[model samples]
Target: MNDKANNIKRQIAITRRDELGHPPLHLDNNSRLCLNCNRAINDEINIIEADPACLRLNVLTQSASQTCVICNAQEDIGRLTIHCRVNVFIEVNIYIPDNVRSCEHHLDENGMFHNRLLPGLRFINRPYLIKGPQLQLFLQHLRNVSANKVKGIDDKNLTEDEFKCIAPVSKQQFEELFTYCDPVYYNGKLRQIKRKDLLMFLCKMRQGLSDDFLKIIFDYHSRQTVSSVAACVRTSLLERFVPTNIGLQSITRENFIEQHVTEFANELYNPRPAEPKVIAVIDSTYAYVHKSKSFRVLRQSYCFHKNRHLLKPTLIVAPDGFILMICGPYFSDAGNNDANIIREEFERDANTLREWFQNQDIVLVDRGYRDAVPLLQHLGIDHRMPAFLQRGHRQLSTEDGNESRIITKNRWVVEARNGHLKSVFKFLGQTMNLQHAQNLSGFYRIAGAILNRYHPLINMQDVNAEFARQMLQRSTVPNAIQARVEVDNLRLRNGQWRRLYGEDVPDFPLLDLGYLKDLTMGIYQINLAPSYIQDKLIRENDKELQLDEHINEPGFLRIRLFSRFRNVVKHQIFIAYTANEMENIDNNADNNPISGYYCTCQSGARSLGTCAHVASVLWYLGFARHQPNIKYPDTSLLDTTLDAAYRQPADIAQNINVDVIDIN
Candidate 1:
């Protein structure tokens, strides 16, 4: 009877659970649904059972979605929904803990939030997580953006300032050059480097920077890489850029005459009726070099003029400073003098200079090219060089002096142009290293090309041709006063003149600085005259002056001044002055002076204009002397004579023909 009662109790419990519409606690593996709501659970949601027989579903989902079905069912059935087994996964791994006790939360190391919690779930701190593939894609996108911002050589994205730092030419000009040197390849690989970058590298090299320094600045991997790239680019530039920009073929003879030949050059150089068709100024410039290991090379590279090892290159430029051609980085030995190098350029079968040059083409040169004069004459070329000083004469004759000055005035452009090349490209200024010494010709050629393409005209504008013409005409005139004084032996006639010093001549004329500049034709000599005067004053206290009362006309005074080039050497300068008589003369007037002037200095003897020595005397007498207690800025007091003596030990000086004089 008791067993029958227990069986009835178990049956009643089963029947009550069935009447409540509850399903079995365990289901097949294919079933994934909440027991309370009989709804499908999301695969992403987590489900947890409280016990094997009683299912306690913990559905974890995003907060943006509706609450889990189990929670809704529990709420509808009038049970507490707060204890329902469901968790929302909103704001996961979003906020990090603040160890500094600040009011705000901070981002994690990966720039993301940490310690994210769901609405019904417990708060937890964890590492910020991102899918591997998503993170990789995002990083790659950032890399692409950064690369796009960085401009390559060929790109037109660089600013003008940035572009100019690399290349002397403009972007448009570089593009044109790019088309010419476009197909540069190295080691069978198409050059990935941009033309602009290559050009910038070349310019940096020319600027005299070390390969190591360039590598750091340019983001190159190694110094070797920078050197290699620079070499390749330089080779390309020499092959294409130099031929088109620098060579003789670049400009036709007609164009050269019409555009480049200045009117000042024509007037000054072509004064005679038998003038040549073209006037070219020629000179040799030296590049310093290291002492070679080989005895033959060391002997060959020694330059007596520079007192060092050097390479000499002949530069032939137009009178306007346009470089026409460059010939040979000839060895600086005795046999390879400037004259010989120039002769080779003309006579050598390999050279085109002889074929291109026509008869009667005037070439202006300095005294260094005197040996080449006969060769030039043989080729029917008229070469004009400065006259040499006579051995016994204190100064050149007035005619010879005047002729020399004319040649110098026109030939100065070539010297200035050579200076410009050295100034712009510092690589040329410094002694080239052994590695680059082998390719000196190529370097020189490239430098010439760069200057021709980018540098400004050496003579910025044509000089006043009319003024030049008048000067040229006046240079031919003989100084009557100078001739008379010499013929009459006026300097020796001491009784005919009163001796005067700076202190005795208080009536010295007053003149303006502008007047001095006009007299000298340029400020360089005038600016230098004060230093020369200061040097003379500091070194020699008792400067002598003699006034010739016999030759004194109404407004003229003849004075003899003692001048010295060095301590042991003394010379006399004869001055014929016509005092300014106009009471209200403007200070700016060019003729405001002791108007008529001449000196015994080589250049002053020329009727072309006054020399620095003559200008200095005139300035001192007219302006500087009249200023009471005026002070001049002290210049370098380094006595080169003492410096040289100090460099040598005592006994060696006696063996060398060194004549020691007491400077004190």
Candidate 2:
């Protein structure tokens, strides 16, 4: 009963296969036919293992595997195991060419043919059997003739080496088998499969072959092919990687100071002027190189200023060793004096400068800047020059050494700038011949700024006069304020004199004294007879000095401008003369010695400082009295009480009436 039940179940399963359009029952082992066409079936093939019974079987198992009844062709769908199956097939009517020798060479020895005798005879690599009678017959009428039209028998057996190369050895075998071969992707179908594409890929990876390198490696035909490959890589690197990140171009003052200044300052003493505690020391240097010998040299002009031949650039430096301005790289033969160049640059921005110079901002300079006074006057700037111990005035009074100390101590900045520039840019320090001069000029002007921006500044003096003065007055200052003191002092010194003269209470109208007898034929001031004026002034001075030989050393009188003020006060001249000698000299008469006086300005001193001709008249007319300290002190100090025998005091505060004059 149980056996009968099993037989029924098997019949039912077979019935289901027929219903699902499965392969025909009782199919031939070697001969085949399509389910749809019965006439000697031959066409392309497909192997599908979808049903439970066929799913675990290899496709090429012929009848044991599922067959495509529509084509009668077979396909192997199996996993690779590093080996191919040995097929000791019934080596039927296939001919092996004598030239194609094999490990197992004999075939059809018993006529029925031992398949094992023909190595790879059961299934070997496919090769066309075009001359075979069976294949020739079907190919003539085959549809899709280019496809796998089964027409010939491939009877080949696998040798031990060939079998192992095709399939990996395993300890056990199972009914289910896998057919693994080429992958879905052509480039990397099987990892170890050495296809043409695989070899090329490996060449790229191993050698890091760039397009050009690869082209030469493989002997590619043209530059266009290699260039196209390289351009893609280059474009990718530039746009996708390099451009989106930080690069080398972003340098600015604020960015630089923030990123580097603190770290740099900590490394050294590189505090900048922008920082509160730092000072900048600025100076100019020049660059020189060989040029044609026929270059033009600067012409010889008497530079009353330096009194020496020089090709110079005006380098204004800070007290802290920072360069403030490298004003020029001017040419010597360019017909520009130092003063002239300075004036031109000053006027170029006069209004801005005038606005900058307030009460205490100082400019330090050298004596070549005598014209500094006028230029700065227009700008409202104050300037200073070091005491030329030769000019011989009372800037440093002998009373105390304070004035001398102040002038000498602060004057080194300008000198240092001049010396520093000459030393570093040695060619510029000396005279230039001509050819390389202009290039050197540009170098000198620009090099300092470059040096200052890059090099270390050192030995900066802490005193910034403007900063200190403004601090006292409670004022704010600009970061790069170039309140050059000496340049301004020169102007202020002159301007103050002009103002002093302009503001003075008219002691006499600075008038047409040309009408006076000695002043005839020329515009003159407070003119008087030279001889008569001389007698009167000298006679008066003799009342005290007695115009003795002791007092009358050289000339009869000394004359200078009146109104004691900056540079010099006014054009109005004053004279103190001598008549009687204090001692009886053999050359002149006795106790009636003529009195003598002199002035420090141009009106006296043989017209170097001042002249005697003008001096005499100024003294004779008592214009000398207008000046408080002349040859003799003014007698205004004498009170009536001191003079009265009865001790009656002269009136004090006589001008108590309210009449105010505005000095400004």
Candidate 3:
């Protein structure tokens, strides 16, 4: 009889324009004992009913309806009824997702409410204009609807089918599942999605590249924000994925020995080598740091080591054909010597280090690491750095010298690893700073984690194959040993080339030197070593004496011209060299007959220059003359620029040095 009476029209009350200034809270059912924030309003309960709770009824005949009431709400006598009853009240716990957080609502026992903003409107309805992420807004709306407990609408209650949204789950259930996580307090960041939804998505993908796929869920975000967030997450999640001591502490020596070492060794030997088997190699690379702002004031002096331009980090690595160790990057203040870095890395004690050695652990370090030999022995590490006679190391025996060359020839692995590490993170070379220190350390740890995901350059099969090949070559043809003998014989026939020219070379071909040219150039940036490395061996009872120090040992060792060609044969330097590296040709001498070929120094292999030694060796074999074809540079031929009259411009020469220089 009263089905039409089921159509409940909420009472609307319109106040006069003069009475529109009161707070809407005064129109509530009972302001004297109201705790609206913590109290829920539900209409049409089984015992009672609720509607028009969230909405304040306002009836207007001729004037605009306003929401205002007197202190005595029941006595106001407005043209509307402010109904507050329970229609669908149900006591239940909430189950909020981890990503969804709840706000704290406060209402005093005396029915008064106050907060930084409004009591119940915990967060501002900012209405994120964000495109793809309307999910947050959807959740917010559900909360608003649930707080008021409005009656449900079925298919017949709505006019349009498409407008019919699904029924919202109970809000209490969601809240029970997740504790509110205040993102502001957590960090100055916001959660873009509900925790439950995010976890669900992650679980669904179940792959290593979950972050890449996260873009789809947040496509509505601004492109710039999205990209930045993605990048930050990439770096951040790297820590999450890989347990490192800096972040989650996940690295140890066991992993290095079992996983990384085996992986690297395999790769080195699996592939065929061009010549003799490369057992091990050693090299050093420099890591740089930021400038010191206080240096000028505190130090009151500018030293290259501590100067603001750059700091130094030197690394000793095993870079042979196989698995290499990131041995020691002796980190220090700027303006430190390379040799000193080596001493630090080896712990300054010879006998103490011998315990860390594995079988066949040949160290291919630079001559700067000479002091580390005694320490290397302690660990059973074979130290095979090249002989820099001028720097006062004992002269190499014919056999020892050749062995050094062989080790160096295969020592390019350090350079490659150094290149990969520094290049991937250029900021490591920028001026060191407080925050940067943390970042750099994190960078190294996170990078290792990323590397683990991908396959290493080495593998077990590869190691086995390479090991087999090396064994075959050593038994069958002995490439390095034989080459060394031949080179020594050549030098013997030619006599010593060191003192033959005995001239300080000021102007060598800058273009001819390749790799070393660049390294030297960089060292020159901080004034490391810029000039030619001169050398001559003096023999006393078959022992050798250097200008700086003499090591008289019982062996067939003699100090002759430390020929520039020495390095090129097996110690192929990848850069240009100064005249000191060659025959030291005099600028005004008329006695010496100059060679007409490229420099025999390793520098020639790196750049376009030829020192006196290279020139002499090539001339003896007649390779300096121009030869047609084979343009990569003939260690055997020389193409003269004699056809042109003008010399290289000063700017070009200056520019060349800069191009090659890199600071340690």
Give me candidate 1's TM-score against the actual structure: 0.67
| Clashing residue pairs, backbone N/CA/C < 3 A, model 1 | 94-113, 94-114, 95-114
lDDT for model 1: 0.61
Worst 10 residues of 1 by lDDT: 79-88
**Structural RMSD, model 2:** 36.5
TM-score against native, each model? 0.67, 0.26, 0.38
lDDT of 2 by residue, 1-664 (tens): 1245334333433443564457856523343334533221111111111222322111121222332222233453222111112122212322322122221112121122232333323221112223366445434434333243242111124354442232221112100111111222212221211122222222332233444555554344454544333333222223322222112222333433444332222212221334422222222223222333433532333233545444546665544444545555554443565566677666775574334334333455555566656765655444654344446553222211222223333345556655555554343444544443544444353334323443455443333434233222321211110122223342233322322221122222221122221221111223222333323333333221111111322222222333323533532232322332222223323431222223333322221111334434433333332333323222234343255444322222221112332111
Instruction: Evaluate residue 553 in candidate 1 and report its C-alpha lDDT on the 0 to 100 scale.
Output: 49
Full candidate order by TM-score, most accurate first = 1, 3, 2
How many clashes in each candidate?
3, 81, 95
Report how far off residue 86 is in candidate 1 (Å). 46
RMSD (Å) per prediction: 19.3, 36.5, 19.7
Q: Which 10 residues in a row give candidate 3 its minimum summed lDDT?
A: 81-90
How well does candidate 2 score on lDDT at residue 235?
Answer: 29
As for lDDT, the candidate ahead, 1 or 3, is 1
Best by TM-score: 1
Question: Per-residue CA lDDT of candidate 1, range 527-592, in tens?
Answer: 555555654554443343334445354334554333545555434455654455543346555664
